[model samples]
Target chain A: MSVASQDTTIRTGRVTRALIYLTLLLFALFYLMPLFVMVVNSLKPLHEITSGNMMALPEVWTIEPWRKAWSEAQIGVQATGLKPYFWNSIKMVVPAVFLSTMLGALNGYVLTKWRFRGDTILFGLMLFACFIPFQIVLIPMARVLGIFGLAGTTWGLVLVHLVYGIGFTTLYFRNYYAAFPTELVRAAQIDGAGFFQIFWRILLPSSGPIIVVSVIWQFTNIWNDFLFGASFADFSSQPMTVALNNLVQSSHGVKEYNVHFAAAILAALPTLLVYIVAGRYFVRGLMAGSVKG
Target chain B: MGFLDIDNTTKSYGPVEVLHEIDITVEEGEFLVLVGPSGCGKSTLLNMIAGLEEITSGEIRIKDQVMNGVHPSKRNIAMVFQSYALYPNMTVGQNITFGLEMHGVPKAERDKAMNDVAQLLQIEQLLDRKPGQLSGGQRQRVAMGRALVRNPDVFLFDEPLSNLDAKLRVDMRTEIKKLHHNLGTTIVYVTHDQIEAMTLSTRIAVMNGGYVQQLGTPKEIYDTPSNLFVATFMGSPSMNLIPVKLRVDGEAVVAETESSEGDTLSLSVPNPSARLKSYNGQTVTMGVRPEALTDAEGADHRSTHIEKVLNKVTVTEPAGSDTFVTTTIGGAECVARMRADTEATPEEVTEFAFNMEKAVFFDPKSEDRIV
Candidate 1:
């Protein structure tokens, strides 16, 4: 009887439905306001952006700001734009994301299926690492990079992000793999598969959702990182976030508001593109391991 | 040595022992079932045989080869897990042939083996389909196919049918039995279901609290259960343990109990076991199966003695095929398996034809059968 009564409560009348959608649309536009400002202002010339209303459509559209932002704008006393630093961010983010996700996966597999004594404690310490302030590790991380002769290099940034990103990636993959059936691993063991074989053939293939979650998470975190970038990276190997900061702060006379806006949009593009492509999976992946199959 | 020998095996976790010393030898082509309640260590024993869990003590040998410290794959054993554990990413064909591929079998040989297993399991149509695309029964078949493809010396089944619907469980049970019959493989099956243990295994090891309570054939376990737990645990609705006063009636021992009508109902114990003589004058339990306590028309005519007692009926459940009549005997609720048209109803005093020949005595103190 209660179930039958729940059927009517599940549905809304036309007016209620329209009101709900209208409220949702209003919230959507409210959140999209910053992107709207950036896009509109970025397409206008410097004079128009300086003189005209920020949210108003450009009277004379121009791509000069974008072109300058891509190639000719002064970033940290260099007129090399955000292009070189963009590639640096890509180089750092890709390997960092790939290495961290893979290492996290291997750590997750070992922690869950091939358990040893004090493994929980080890996992607890790793989880504790996730909560540690990134600022606290910066000094030690810089020293370690110095010892390894990788300080001020793009690879140093890669190593820094990889180490920092491991905790979160392991947390994601571990939780996801924890819900995975141990019987399958045992079955694979009985089927004559070795450690890496079982991981590659059985575990990795089924880890689609969690992998997306890890990649997207690592990509965004590494790309958008400002603290680590500013603290470690030199002028040559500075990532996009640090370069974007220099681009915004370096101009002495004219503000170059359009150029700053254009550079800012470029700095935020990859993460935005990643979210646009795999955002749905991010939510689904987070929900997957929280509830058991 | 038998095909598979579990010789005095014990399993422990630090200070706690989960499975006591268990010893059972299984012949080649024999089906042995370990049936018990949850937390009874039945699955632990099966895992020991499969080399899944390390043995705490004693030896598990397959075909005279000591299996301690042996890898699971090298032990020539394949297990069907409770969840079926089909690799979700692999197609039916790849899933079945995984073991062969891992063992470095040639691709052509692995493909042939996979095809043979798929054909044997009648899953030829689902070859290209992933495990996620298959239904529960189909996944079960694929699990079996994976095991069957290996054609190992011993097959271990860990509650494999438990994940299916009741109807499908029964169907798969029959099919597994048929497959065993045709293949003549040495299978060590583990289930908490006594009916599955009864219907499938050539022999059964009824376990409780990490102990093998009784090990025997189905009829031996059913008719002559070694202890009180085995007597009650192996049957549906279980055996009724009626508290009765034992008294020597001339040459025979008689079990006397207070009926539902508040009258004395006496049942004779013919040809009592020699050890049962010591139980005279003491209050003991009389274990009787539901079928043994029936109406006049429902009684087994072959039995020489059918003690008649008029007891008050408490409940009558008409279950299509057999009507189960509930009545009180010896201060315990007893159920009698009656015919579909059984005349007994609640509140009415009906005559029960008790088959004393099927009754067994249990000592109240030890909780073991008075054998």
Candidate 2:
């Protein structure tokens, strides 16, 4: 209405837009800088990598490191290297993700739809178990695995991953299921669907985002785990994470930057591929729990 | 045997008692509505009948067989939820046929049933689409289709129209009534809305505080409420209740209020019982529905024959069909529904005829109807 007021409004709007742009620019840098450095350095030779400025561009780019890492990283037991261990990681993670997702869906369905005495206490215990650190369960879980003669096998790690993964997966599912109306569950019951029938046919079909979330979370956690892999399995059954630790992280090495960098990239590729595939569902699932529909 | 008999049924969750001594016997092909405000145990009662909730203390018999411990799927009942609980992943056809498939119906029969219900609900074109693809009203019809395909002996609807918009709700309400008319299946519906109760129910059970306050046909419940709660709950704009002292003026009973006309309005009740006559000098509550009061001269109804009471109208709300005039009578505010043609200015004293013929008297202490 007035010249001064109109001028102030325009100035304020411009400032707000500028502030938003500045904030986004900073956040993008914060997330992408490390990734950019890793990709660029992975292409550099040892001399170029060790010449001190790690963030600087390479003098020459070559795929030699990737080639060497794959072959020299041994696809067999004698070498304790990347290729064999990577396949082992895949084998271990696939089952863990599948089983964890299925069990999480079941847990969510029961907690939200079924009513019984002490259901609250059971839910509270699950929440409490989620807050319990994995460090506290190591000895007891190892002992249990030893009794089953699965202490050093891939199946043993699968069990461990599933045990730890259920806490988070169930929490994700339980909260998601809470948002669904109880009437839907009742209708399913009246439709003559049994427990497993409802889970597989009715509930699971609509649980797109939650299934993706549980799979991605369990796969990433199992693939990235070094401590559990080292403690639970020996060299033969060891996953890439543990084997990579011996290859790149052992203090006795002469610090083969090329091999270390290449191995790190190789190990991270699975999770990166998973994120690219399930990125949308992961974000949708997270938003569903925290926001109104 | 009755079509569905719930005899002395009760439900309690842990320490919380939700329903008490519920008894409802729905005749074959009858439409029953359970109407009450939230937490009044109407939905719980419906759920118990549907076998969704466990009955704590009595028997539920369906066509002479005990159904108290039976699972919901085995109860021979179909329920339409308030959320229109159509499966999001299944097509409308798949959703409708799911119940029949679970019951081991042959493929041919299931298809025929699905097609029949879809055609009946006029959703044949939308049968291939998922619930998410359809609009709210379409999803509701699909839900109904699912229930109808089951061909259960009884249908239970739990506030099915509460989710729809006002216009959509009206349309669905009529569709449901028409569906009942065609199917001739017994139905037990639950809703907090009184208008739905009045329109959809063949028999309305008004529940309050975990008890059935009154149960009757919609007209009976509306015209002759058993108690103060039913009288107030059944009607829109509610019934106007005014406290007055009953006294004998010569040969007739006179209820006098100083604030209203500053005098007594003498009237007589036919065959007054000893209990009612005992309160001759005591205070009682008189309830008059808004529709009962009109422009004294316009309707020429029996309401005109009673004593003419003069009062000042404070507000006149003209709602298309009728003008709701709020006036002060007997020191209390009373709403009278007049013909839309009636003209009255605010703050002007007007003569409103009283309708004693349909009016009810309540014992002020207990808030129960007095015979």
Candidate 3:
């Protein structure tokens, strides 16, 4: 009788697990539906998209919409391409991410290890910077850019991102460093290592997960940003997101839904690639960085 | 001038003083252990010596040179932390050699030093392994190797064996003592373990409430503790303190204590000091070790003074070689050590002999030893 009862329990456990998996699969599909629709419609020809079902695979797949979205689309007054703006984004993001991450590392090291009186208050004020909405800073930043004659330039956009991104990068690194053992730093000091030497040899080498976290966080934030990009950039320096917005909204002719979808996908490729390459570290970094010393 | 001297050191944060006027001096090769319970400022003192924490007031001198504001590296000291503090990203070899590399030592010299330390620590096989890959004992060795490669003027160890298991702790304790003997380097170790302090130190500074309560050899601290706190803190199954009245009985100084049943027990004190003579008719504290009170037949009869007392046994705890027999005296629980084979059952009155030659007296109000 006990054997039969155990068998019944095992069978019920299996059925419960199966039901959980079924529910998860359905939720996964629901979340993926828009992405599926975007890819399907982006691949379809204009005539097929106009008449065929949205859920169906493209009856006649074509690369024309992707081509047009890249080179021939109208973005604002310019009809050049997203290719130039894509280069603009690369120029803006590379330096911005690199500079902010370096500054944040220094900030974190000093804030956590070499702290002085009022340092905690200073860090708290800096943390307040991370929560401020971009709209709140937009006007003053634009005015500052104008005063410096940096308005509507790639450098101006880089400056804007750097100023705002430092807060988040600092927060990430500070949390990560707070959990790092402090004895290593003291040991290095006694080993005759000076400040920068300790940072370079001892601290930086152990900062792999946090570096990934800060870089990816800054890269995605600057890449997908539309408000700052549009406000700070001009005709020649607009980022890919702003250009994509203009490309879809410009109504020189009938709406090209397929081209719009392709353009949106093209604009999102870099961030998606970043996630796919280093996605595992992202979660690990977040979890490890949150642990307090 | 002493090799290392901490003179009139006091540490305070805001208005709260943590360590108050601590003074310690060590010879060239003395092993000094600063021992106390947690929050007793032992680690704070060590850190101040290492220059990790600033000294608020007082002068710290090494080799007769003042070291008040000297950087830790410039002061030429190495520390073995409780956590080991090996660089997790570096291999054992690199960890050992990092100090040399920081001082701009040549690659050949660094490697030579690293090899010597690794061999000394018997960690040559672990040179290529990262700290994360090594066991607790191996990591401890690597931490020591890191400090050893420096060959600094003084060595600081902060509870270095506290993280190990019980068995490993004992093994490593012996290893550390052997290492100290082989090197004969001046060492200042901090620990809360009384046994570690007693076994390792050439001189022990017993700290309490941030003050150096007593500074002496382990034997001196154990046999002639200066006060009530030091007497109780240094021993296991600590020294039993019973309230007693001192009286002169026919030229012999005797301590009189009352049992729970209102019977008086008188034990004669051997060689009572001149200072103890003033408290003839007043109350005082009598501290006796459990070994001093034992089964009558097995008691050491060679002592000059011994008193037999009959008390009802309240409990018996057999601890392998000796059994601790507990009985009530003057409303306080007193333990007597007995031979394990002795049949002193609980609830039966047993005759135990008390050796009074080693007993000490403390003033009731001040708690300071009378002599």
Clashing pairs in 3: none
lDDT digits (tens) for residues B1-371 of candidate 2: 68899899888988878898988899998999999889999888888888888889989999998998798999889999988888888999999998888888999999998888888999999989999899999989999999998889899998999999999999999999998998899999999999999999899999999999999999999988889999899899999888877876545566666444566555555345566667889989888888766667644454434546777889999999889999877777889888887877688878777766767789977888887
- How do the predictions measure up, each by TM-score? 0.94, 0.91, 0.94
After TM-score superposition, the amount by which residue A207's alpha carbon in candidate 2 deviates from its true location, in angstroms, is: 1.6
- Here the TM-score of candidate 2's chain B is 0.96
Model 1 CA lDDT for position A34: 91
Worst 10 residues of 2 chain A by lDDT: A72-81
- lDDT per residue for candidate 3 within A1-293, as digits (tens), equals 99988776745577889999999999999999999998999998887878878889988888888888888877777667688888999999999999999999989998888889999998999998899999999999999999999999999998999989889988998888999899889988888899998888888899988999999999999999999998889988999999998888886787889999998999999999999998899988888889643
- Misplaced by over 4 Å in model 2 are A1-61, A74-81, A249-256, B247-259, B270-275, B300-306
Candidate 2: deviation at residue B161, Å? 1.6
DockQ-better candidate, 2 vs 3: 3
lDDT (tens digit, per residue) of candidate 1 on A20-86: 9999999999999999999999999888877779999999898889999999998777689889999
Residue B70 local lDDT, model 1: 98
- Is model 2 an incorrect, acceptable, medium or high docking prediction? medium
Writing each residue's lDDT as its tens digit, candidate 1 over B8-65 gives: 9999999899998999999999999999999999998988888889999999999999
